[model samples]
Target: MPLSREKIAATAIRLADAHGLDGLSLRKIAKELGVGPMRLYDYVTNRSELLDLMVDVVYARIADVGQHSEWRSTVLTIAQATREAALEHEWFADLLGGRPHLGPHALAVGEANAAALSEAPAVRGIDDLQRALGALNAFIIGAVRREVTERRTARSAGTDEAAFQASLGPYLTGMLKTGRYPTIARLVIDGAHLNAEETFNHNLALVLDGITSRPRT
Candidate 1:
């Protein structure tokens, strides 16, 4: 049977995760699918279309997530899902710009997040959706970019995150301890043991705090 579009798009997503956006090409996809490069052209016109399809596939995974009564919960679900997607396809970091419009996955994820803001009692009216969606997209994108950038920098330094920090600890610690940046030093000392999960949770809570602590009257 000829491959369905869903099959093609799903394959593209796995390819993006395995090889990133740069390494993905019609030839590469064809190889993975056990076909000729021309076979892909039958379904997708070019590499850009493939990337768009791959992103939409990810959107499909999280599309049905945020439809409940609480808007904050919706955003949290979106935040986690987007982070997972970004980490899976670290190359997406380089490919997300210049979008003509949000694809299915991106739009579905946005709808989930928008559901969260929709539940907020104070965040009513038409413009509120825009504010909520903007805040959520910014937060998720920022979190993933910081995370991937740190991982890339660590790789460039020829070490993982913990080891890189250890290698630089002496100099950085000294600068902190000597009162160059006392607050930074204290947080580093106090936060040295916090893992990625803890860090993400903390950041999520901080964002939620900002949303919740606002003047609701």
Candidate 2:
């Protein structure tokens, strides 16, 4: 088959899924595609371009939340969809927020998010919209990274989240006993350990609330 950008990006994504970004290279993708590495350069200019293409391939999977009557709902839908995509492509979290995504699919996703927030009643102007999107992006990226890290940790530990937590229970308990961190001790004693989805939704709502509640200037 003739080499194409799509083919190159797809092979790169598959390699990344298995070996992660560090394992991904033009040579590896070329090997996977049964072509010389130099041939890939014909399609992708360089490693950076390859990464951009890989990121866009993943972004293409995210469904548009579309414009909705309630801006919050639209924002929430977009956030959820993004999280889902990142979870599916664990490498996505590493690339996300690292640089601007100018690909068509990435721009479509951004456009949807911007449109939703722009129509928000509390959004005073461009500044408000920028801040709101910035906040959402920060939360989404952080949350996804945390979740992905935990997943990798759990897998590496050869245990589930509960087992891993249990393994840490002794050390954590001992640290909490220090009394130097009173609030943290209290949280250890009383805080609910929400699952990843619950934690994401709960925190996302809080973020959205903060954005809407900000005073219009």
Q: Model 2, residue 14: displacement in angstroms?
A: 1.0
lDDT of 1 by residue, 1-217 (tens): 4776688877777777776676777787678778887877888888777778777776676675546556666667777766776777787655544474378667766656766776766566667657755665677667778888888889889999989878997888778867878778778877656677568867887777666655644
- Candidate 2 structure quality by residue, lDDT tens digits, 90-150: 9999998888999998888888889888887778889888988899899999999999999
Where does candidate 1 clash, by residue pair?
59-105, 71-116
lDDT of each: 0.72, 0.87
**TM-score for every candidate vs. truth?**
0.82, 0.94
Which candidate comes out best when scored by lDDT?
A: 2
lDDT value, residue 23 of candidate 2: 96
* Model 1 residue-pair collision total: 2
CA displacement after TM-score superposition, residue 142 of candidate 2 (Å):
1.0
